[model samples]
Structures are given as structure tokens and as C-alpha cells.
Target chain A: MSGYHIAIVGATGAVGSKMMEMLEEATFPIESVTLLASKRSAGKVKNFKGMELVIEETTPDSFEGIDIALFSAGGGISKQFAPEAVKRGAVVIDNTSAYRMDLNVPLVVPEVNEEALRTHQGIIANPNCSTIQMMVALEPIRKKYGLKRIIVSTYQAVSGAGISAIKEMEDQAQHMLNKEGYEANILPCSGDQKHFPIAFNALPQIDVFSDAGYTYEEWKMMNETKKIMADETIKVAATCVRIPVVSGHSESIYFEVEDELATVFGIQQELMIAPGVVLQDDPDTQTYPTPLTAVGKKETFVGRIRKDLDEDKGFHMWVVSDNLLKGAAWNSIQIAESLHKLDLVKI
Target chain B: MSGYHIAIVGATGAVGSKMMEMLEEATFPIESVTLLASKRSAGKVKNFKGMELVIEETTPDSFEGIDIALFSAGGGISKQFAPEAVKRGAVVIDNTSAYRMDLNVPLVVPEVNEEALRTHQGIIANPNCSTIQMMVALEPIRKKYGLKRIIVSTYQAVSGAGISAIKEMEDQAQHMLNKEGYEANILPCSGDQKHFPIAFNALPQIDVFSDAGYTYEEWKMMNETKKIMADETIKVAATCVRIPVVSGHSESIYFEVEDELATVFGIQQELMIAPGVVLQDDPDTQTYPTPLTAVGKKETFVGRIRKDLDEDKGFHMWVVSDNLLKGAAWNSIQIAESLHKLDLVKI
Candidate 1:
């Protein structure tokens, strides 16, 4: 943990750049930092701390002496390079879907499942942005009340797709205002067959739909919740939607607990003490968590807590968090810290 | 029905302007059109059918010779002026919440409960925008397969609040982009104590929270659904969220039907032929309804239809419609058409 050689894969991408920023802010004890990306992004300069680090082309030989590799590249790149990094004895923390649901790979959110990091062999998978924030807000309640069922509808930001999606939104909005036609090229899903404009709109499909009629994004939340919580009996359903927001992901969650006596006040009390969570549920003060206010912040904000009138054991809450921070880079860095504290990262 | 004199209250507001446009498009054999507003907007001029109409201040005597009066002002104005219109032998279509659940006032969506217009004594109540779009999308399904329950999450547009909310969203987004500090004055709820910026964000509380733990917007959807569908046994719950979108309202609806054997294809077929509904549920083509696409359109768009994995009786769909058109103006004009068709209008 004193002096480690670290490599950040996909260094030119959105999450990759954020990871570099977070590492600088956290000032991790690194002997050397290598920035790696595809051949197209090679030779690009990325500023870290007080030094301008040039991005290098990623290859199998690039992980020769790296102690830790953080992968934020696409799933294909992760699938191709992550195993190579692990083979070179580097602990890989992948931010792609390549290994998230793998039986051997631990999907970690530091606030919710830091203990799971103890079992990671060489690679740890970061959960989806929307799922990570929701688990952070709900884990405290789940620990106290014994969660049984969860139904969530996510209003996710455009940045969850990437920097290109944000630019497309801005450009499309400007074109719309100027009475010009602008083609949508980067959303509902980047890899999907077609794109839809998200400026001043909502798209229900966050990822390509699978055979069972659920988008990959929704399925990711469902399976990732089960894996992170280590509970097979908990029922989870998700409807992932893309809104025009830039950073924070907001979720409307309806949850049912095994304990029927859990009240709204009890849930609020639990969230008040939860680490990395802020309670903003004062009705008289007109206080509630909104994505605009939660942007650029690290904490998961929870509010609008109320008991369901029909279901005795059910409650509803609104959760908001900066998707780029707690959902991606910040969580990845926190996991690295957890690994260090647990003495699981080997040099 | 020939040469009827009509008046529009709140003519300067968002819905009122849309109502005026719809009246012009419908070309409803009007002898004269009177625009009425508050003292501030009284002297303004509005164009209808190539003629300039001076907006008059709304008062008791404003409805003296009016055959029909459309009210889009707030509840206080509706409560004060509706009876005056009715007393002057004019049929009143009130777009506010003052008399929606009055039990005496017939709440109607022309596509769903046009028959209810036959029983209206004087004042007819228009359902909430979210409720109107959902009812239009679900009524055909309800008729084919008796509905039991509904759960909806709304991605509502800022224009649903008014023109000021739209302006606030535009201003806030530009201010945020330019790194300038600006106040939030019209979002979440204009009448509420505090305002939050809606640009690049999602606000969970649409209106003030009521005693039942649901926002006023949610309550309006729940009650209005029951009244329009005329089914007291149907259970409905809603979580209404205001997004940065400007025009159309989108909803994710989960419904349970008495017919458990209905397939997704069956529901799609039903929605395709249903009146005032356009089915856009092709995942292969990546075609779906969005607010930006539904802007100026009059039809309610339904897509993303799928069956619940575990529940045989459950189905999910995404519903989108122009809040100003089908939700307000066109619905009002349709009611007027229904009145004429039923010979209910006394001109």
C-alpha cells in the first residue's frame, strides 16, 4: 500500500478521465501512474496532479509491471485486456459490463459491499451507475428492516452514456431552439441499432432489449442487486429511463420489507446515520433531493420518504446521486482504498 | 351548433394559448371568440381565425352571452368564475382542480368517457394531464380486459406547470452551462415555499406533499383516473416526477388485468386500433415515443409494451402525449365536439 504502480485503462474516455481526477484528489500512494487507451487516443496528454501524462496505446505487454489497473473502456476492450492485466499479476478494477455478472468476479460498491472485496481474485467489477447509487441509499434500510422486494424507476443522466451523449444533447437542444433538424446518434444506447434525441425528452430504453423483454440496463440492476446483497430471495424489478440531465441519477423506489412494523420515520432515521448518505426529507421546509443540486457532490441524497397507503410493510423514497462520482470513479477509488485497508491488494 | 359564441379564460397562459390554437384548427363554427384574462393581461391582443381578439378582464359578467367558456386558470379563479359562467347558461369546461372530484361535476376525457358529458349540468372537469394521457392509452385495454390495478411513474415536462417553468428551465440550464448563479423560482411547485432548478435534473415532488404521502400531482392522477374510468374498484398509485423536458408528458405504467392470458402482442394490437392512440412499439426499428417527437402532435403515443416476467396478469407500457394538446386543448375541443354530437350544447 505504500508505493504501487497503477495503470488507468481507457484514459481518454469520460469515466476514465474522472478516475484520473479522483485519484489526484485522493492523492493515492502511487510509485508510477500509466495512462492507457486505444491506438486512436494514444499520445493525448492528460493532466494528473502537477504532471501531464501522455496516454499510451493499450496492449497485452502494457501491464508488465503495473500493480493495479483500472479499466473504464468498453466491454470489448475490457474482455480483451482485463485478463491480460490479471495474468501479469495486476489487480484489475473493471468499470465495464464484461465481468460484472461473472460468477468469479466480485461486483463491488464500496459503501454497500466493501466486504465483498475480500474475495476478489484479481479483478473486481463495478456495478451500473444507476444501481450503485440506489444500493448506496437503500443498503442502510435493507440492513435495518430486512429488504424483501424492490421496484425502481430510474431517471438517469446523459453522462452515464459518455461525453459524446452530453454533447449530442447540447447540440440537439440548440438545433431545436434554432428550428433546425439534428440527427440523434448516441442515445438511448450507443451500441444499439438506432439513436433517439434525449434533449427535453425521456427514452424508456436505456439499453438494447433482450429476449425476455427487459432492457440490458434493467437486467443489470436486477442481477447486480442480487449479487451485491448476496440474497437470492429478494425480488427486484427496474425500469431504466434516460433523461436529459448531465450528472445525477434519480430513482423512485418502492420497497417492501419483511418487517411490517418499519415506518417512514424509522427508514429516515436509518438513512440519517448511513455513511455517504444525506437525508433531505423535510416536507414543511419543502426539502427534497434533486439531481440539479446533487451534481458534483459525492453523497447519495435520499428524501420524499413516505409509507404506502395500501401496503402495510411498504415505503417509497426518492434517491439522487452524482453518477460520475459515487456511481463510477469515486466508488472505484473507494474500492481501491478498501482493498488497501483489508490488505487484499498485493504488490 | 351553428355560429356559437365562445370565451377562453386564462388566455395568456400555456394551456390557454394551446386551447386557442386548437379552436382555430378545429374551426368550430364560431360566431365570435372572446379572450379573457386577469387585469395584467387584459389589454393584450390574440389572433384567432384571421381576426384580432382583445383580451378582456375576467369577471362575473364576462360570460353573459357566451355559449361555452374554457377555463385554464388556477383553482381559485375556476371556483370563483365557473358558477358565474354556468349561471349565465353557458357550459363550462374547467381545466383546474377546483371541482374535479366534486361528485357532481362530470370529469371527462373525450376518448374515455365522452358519455359522461351527456350528464353534465353546467361545469365539466378536465382530468390532470398525466391522467388524461394514461386514460387514453389504457381505456381500450380496460374495455378489452378489465383492469384491476395501475402503477405509474411520470417523466413530466416543465411546460405542464406553465410558461414560467419552461423559462426557468431554459434560464437555469444556460446559467449552469455559463457557470453563473441563478435563482430557481418556478419549479417543483410554483406555489410551494421553495423552488429547485429543473434544468439537467429531475424533481420527484411535482406539487406539495399531501397527508397521504403522495404529491398533489400524484393524488390528482389517482383520483382523476378513478373518476374518468368510472371504476371505484380500480386501485391506482402514482409517482409523478418533473423533468427538464418542455412539452410532452411521458409515463411508465404497470397495470394488472382481470384477463391473465393476454399477451404483449394482443395488447399492442388493441392499442394500434384504439381511437386517439398510435402504437410505436417496434424494438427492432428503435422507434419509440418521446416528448420532443410528440410536440405539436395530437395523438397519444403508446409503446414499449411487455409482459411482467413473474406476473401473468401484469403488463407494462410507455405512454407519451403532448400535454398541451391531447392533455388540455384537444381534449377540451373534443369535449366540445362530443357536446355538439350529443345535442347537449344549448346555443
Candidate 2:
């Protein structure tokens, strides 16, 4: 696995930058790291291990000698370039919706569906940001309790929308303080027909509404939950919301298990032993996971666990994680690590 | 009903100031107005109707000549002063939680349960802010479709905590921007042992946690829904979160109806025609109700209407309203109007 060549598509984007940072932190043995982005971002130099690597223009030939290609570009770019990379014998890990939900490609969350990586035809799809953190937090619970139903409402950060949305929030907040009007152009979806300012606001629509009346974000949660848990029988409902927070994604989850009644303390203890999960529940001391505190941290923090008043079999919890780390970059790298450990990716 | 003498208890508080502003806007005739606060605020003067009203200490004798009294102070203050006002023959619309669940006292939302005002025994209780907005949004649907279950996740503003909490959010944001450390003394719950900064964060605990592990705010929503709707069969669950926003409260509500096969457009139309509800859903134009736009608005904004994917009998909607307006002060005044129209208030 030593001296493997890697190509990072969308090297100038938010998730791409974080992926680079995580790769550096993980100290993956890299013979050469090729940074690739659009022509506009070409020639931009990003430092890795005290060496400056100039970002090159992304094209079909970018993965000529690359052993692994990580794609955080938009869906169109992935759809066009992923096959090119795979044709050049480089396994592609796509961070867009282009390959997700496709019958051939595996949508992998390392802790929950690491085995899925072994069966990937060419590209492995990363689940939605909100879905990634949630799956990691709930997988252990599901394993222990035999899950039945899940209801989740997400308090998502602005960074999930990309760097432009973060700027929009800041500019809008300053404009509001100055008593000036600013246009909303980046969120709740950039490609959507219109935009709404997210500064000090919560937008219910994360992606376009699907045929079933659920937003694409909600549908992703529903579909990805079944896929990752490998249980079509589990009922899942999600309401995805964008909040003013900049980094972490927080969720209020209520679940009903098929097992006997589980105490809040028991669930907390189970979560503590779960991989990639940290239990932060302590009501008497006012300790709970929050976005500001979860920023820059890799672990998904769970807190505020309690039994549902009317249902002895149901329990509720609050989950928070850095959307950039555990939700996107770190999770993607974790998949790459799983691939290495399982001998699923060749160098 | 002409030239009635009115008094406002807790005149220095958040809801109290909004009440004063609403009284100025109401068409009801008033002969004189009195401002009453604790001994610390006794010497302060609040401007109302182009005249400064000196604040007086709230006591039993303070309600001697008052025709109508509005109480926005804490529950303790309401518990001590409301009976005194009633004993002095003054009708009181109390904004505290002291009597909301009492079988003897009527808990009212002017548009939803105004009929409850007819049976008030001198003192009327205002429902919780989050509950008030949700009921205003749901009552229309409940009346038209007959609601069965309500699951709500709230993105509540800091202002609902008080003026100080709002200031704390601003200070915290500024401190964060300037790289300064500041203590959180008001949020999550003021009475709770520890506090966490709410700037760029979401706190799942709105009020103190109860024996059942639900926060007081969530419990209030569950209990108040039953009391206000006068139906004990309606199943309700709530997750109350405090965001960095200043005023409006936004709720993601999933509700089940007794009838079958209702579309999102149908629910939107029903909400459009419902009293005190403004429909803001238009996916094509990305128009939806946000807390920033709901500030200072008297109506509850309903949008993001969609049917639940798995439930044919269920629908989801996003509801937003100014917590200080329809949630508290304006609702209080509306209750006064209802009482006056029903000839329930003795003047």
C-alpha cells in the first residue's frame, strides 16, 4: 500500500480541502498526491506536509496513474469523470449524489456498511452529510436493540451548503445589523429557483421536493437508513432543516426498538462503547453536545437521552457532529481506510 | 367597554413591553394605564401613548381600581399577584405557566380556544409560546381534518427566554468574533446549574428536565396541546431547541389526521384560509416562512406542506410565528378582546 498515487477532485472546494487535511492527518503513504479542480482553481497551491502542490485542471486524463480518486465535485462532474478514473484503473470514491442509490455502487458509512466497499463496481458513494452522522450514532443502538422506527429532525450547519453559503450567512447577518438588505443567493439550495437568507433563520427545505413530497434530503435519510442498516422493514421519517450554525449538524432523534424497554442510561452506556461515538448526556450538570463545541471534532457526540413519556419502548436523543469531519471528509477517509484493511482497493 | 382602566404587571419584562406596544395598537378604549413591576423597577418610567407611566410595586393594593390587568411576569409573580387582582374585581390575563394546566383556570389562544375565555374565573392563563404558535397552525387543520397525533421539533429564538438572553446571544457572537471568552448565564435554562453559549449553537434543552426526562418546554407542549384542544386522546411529542435567532419560533410539525388522502396543496389552501395563519409555501419560488421574516408578524406562518411518505393519513408543515406577538402579548390582548366580546370580563 506504500507509495500509492492519489488524485483529489474538487481540490478547491470545502469538502475537498477537508479531505486533503484528513489525508494529511492520517499520514496515508502517498507516492504522489495530485490536486485537481476546475480551470478557475488550477495553479492554486495548497500545502501538504510542508510541500506546495499546485491544483491542476480536472479532466478525463487526470487519473492516468492515480491509484485512488476522491471526488467531492458536483454530481455532473462525478458522473462525467468517475467512469474516466475507473477506466484508468483508479477506484473512485464519490462524495456526490451521482452514484449513490445506484444499484451497482455501494453507499458506504465505514462503521455501519464497511463491507459494502468490497462490492463497489467502480465508485463508492458517500451518504448525505446529515445521514452520515446519524447512521454512525444509531448503528450500535440498532445492533443492540433491534430497531423498529426512527424519527429525526436535523439542525444542519451552513457549511453543508458549501463555502458560498457560509459567506451568504455572514454577509446577511452583517447587513441585518447594518439595517441594510442583502440578497439570498446560495441557500437553501443554490440550483433551486429562488434563495432565502439563512442568517438567524431555519429553512425546512434542504433539497428539491421529490415525487413523494419529501425533500431530497429527507429521502436520502430514509433510503440510506435502509441501505446502511440493511433492513427494509425499519420505518424512518426525517425533517431536514438548515440552521444558522456554521459547522456541526445536530439532530433530535426518537426511536422505537423491538427489544424490551431500554433505559436512557443503558442507551448512553451502549453509545459510549460504540465506535466513532461519544456520549455527552448529563442533564444535572447541563452537559450536552452542541455545534460550537463539536466544531473541528471528529466524533459524533450524543446527549439528552431520555425515555418517551407514553411509550416505554421509545427513547429520544440529541446527536451532534462536525459536518465537515465525521459527516464528510473523515467518513470518506474512513471508507478509504476500510478499503485498505479489507484489501478491497489495489495500488 | 369604554374608558377602562388597565394595569400591566412586570412592565419591564420582555412580554410586558410587547404587551404595552400591543395595547397602544389595539382599538380598545382605555381611560388610563398603570405600570407595575417589582420594587427594584418601581421608580422606572415606561412610555405609553405619548405619556410616561411610573412603575409601581406590584401588590394586592396595586389592583384596587384596575379594570383589567395583564401579567407577563414569572409564574411566582403571577401566582402571588393574579389572585390579588381577581380579588380586587379586576380580570387578569396571565402570561405565566402558573395556572395553564389548572382545571379551574382557562388556558387560551385567542383564535383557537377563545371560547375557553368565556369560562375564565377572573384569571386567564396564556399558553406557552411554542404551544401557542403550534396550536394556531394546527387548530385550523384539526378543525378541518381532525388531528390524531402531533410531533413537533422547535427552533425557538433566544428572546423567548427574555431580553437578557437575546443580549447574551449578541454578546456571545461578538465575543466569539473577537476571540474573547464569556460565560453563559441565561440559556438552556437560567435555573439549570450550568450554561452553554447559544451563539452558533443549538441547545436541545429549553427548560429544566422533568422526571420523565422531557424538558419542561416539551412537557408544556404535550400537556398544553391536550388542555387547549380539550381532547385528551391527541398524542403529542415535542423537542424544544433554542437557536441563536432573536424572536420568532419555527416548528417542524408532523401531524396525522382522521381523514384519508390529503395533498400538500390542499393543506396549504386550508392554512391560507385559516384565521391568524399566513401561507408562505411556494417551492418553485423558494418562498417559505423563516424566523427572520416572521419577526414582528402577528400571524403564524405555515409553509413546507407535504404528506408523510409512509403515512397516507399524515402531513408535515413548517410553522413560524413571532413568539412575542401571537405567542404571548398579542394573544393576551386577543384574549382580552374575546373576553370583552363575550361579556365575560366585569368592567
Query: Interface RMSDs of all predictions?
Result: 1.4, 1.5
Q: Candidate 1 lDDT, tens digit per residue, B15-62?
A: 999999999877457888899999999889989878888999999999
Residue pair clashes in candidate 2: none
By summed lDDT, the worst window of 10 consecutive residues in model 1 chain A runs over A23-32
lDDT of 1: 0.88
User: What is candidate 1's CAPRI-style docking category based on DockQ?
Assistant: medium
lDDT of 2 by residue, B227-334 (tens): 999999898989899998989999988889987856677777788888899998876666778998899989999888877776778788889999999999999988
Candidate 1 lDDT over A33-96, as tens digits, reads: 9999989999999898899899999999999999889999899999999999999999999988
> Top model by DockQ, which number?
2
Query: After best superposition, candidate 2 residue B340: deviation in angstroms?
Result: 0.3
Superposing every Cα of model 1 onto the true structure, what RMSD results? 1.8
